[model samples]
Target: MSDGDEPAVTGEEVRNVADLARVDLNDEEVETFAEQFEAVLADFETLDEVPEIESEPDLVNVMRADEVEAGLTQEEALSNASETEDGYFKGPRVS
Candidate 1:
């Protein structure tokens, strides 16, 4: 296909992308991917042709009110802990 106003996808770009992904593609596969990538870019250009949307939809928060809730205390939470130190659960230190 002839090159358009936008730069055409290149086999080198396809190969580079494949290499970054650790994909092993032959020369023919690279050419195929380049064509496919070019088609995707061409399709994306269609977005520019879409008419601007004028209407705006009403937006509102749909969440419950935040409120204080009862929870287990330090002693109660530590009860299930195999190791506790300074009124809290002690875990193995990770370097």
Candidate 2:
């Protein structure tokens, strides 16, 4: 989409975003960030118009050898617990 056709980012929009994110923003900060966000979105729009790239290597999941390793014993694991019952750490029960 052309830059002129793109929706303009405004302070009200920024404030709405901040409210949705549970953030507090003063009027001045909102105004400043609205301008910054508009610039960033314009840059992203420009990038979106570039030709599709295919030179990158295909993504592959890197794996490691599966092996069993020695680990902490049950007693050793529970040793630091403030409370334990029947070989397991005891915690407050949820209602």
Candidate 3:
């Protein structure tokens, strides 16, 4: 809301929001919260006065290209396993 204008929000509106959020607010608290909401909205009006930047955003490829690589052999892969069965790592059994 602009300066000198009535608040866009009212006590009834604030109470509705509080109810939706499951918040408990007395009548005085609702009025206070309504005023705070109006002030916050008024503060946001200042952002409209900010100048917009006129430039294309610079974008870059941050990731390296994928390359083919050699992987570990079966024996190397299984060398450190605490337990193995056939050609696979064996994990603890679950019920």
Give a tens-digit lDDT track for model 2, residues 1-95.
Answer: 23676447977899999999999999899988888898898799899899987797887878987899999999999989999999999999989
Candidate with top TM-score is: 3
Tell me the whole-model lDDT of each prediction, alpha carbons only: 0.86, 0.87, 0.89
Enumerate residue pairs that collide in model 1: none
Q: lDDT tens digits, residues 8-33, model 1?
A: 88888998899999999999999889
Residue-wise lDDT of candidate 3 within 1-95, one digit each (tens)?
A: 64456667889999999999999999899999998998887788778778898988888889999999999999999999999999899999998
Instruction: Give the C-alpha miss distance for residue 70 in model 2, angstroms.
Output: 20
2 against 3, candidate with superior lDDT: 3
Give the TM-score ranking, best first.
3, 1, 2
lDDT of 1 at 80: 89
- How far in Å is the alpha carbon of 46 misplaced in model 2? 1.2
lDDT of the structure predicted as candidate 3: 0.89
Every model's TM-score: 0.55, 0.49, 0.70
Would you list the clashing residue pairs of candidate 3? none
The superposed Cα distance between candidate 1 and the true structure at residue 4, in angstroms, equals 6.3
* Off by more than 4 A, model 2: 1-7, 56-95
Mark the regions of model 3 whose C-alpha exceeds 4 Å error after superposition: 1-5, 85-95
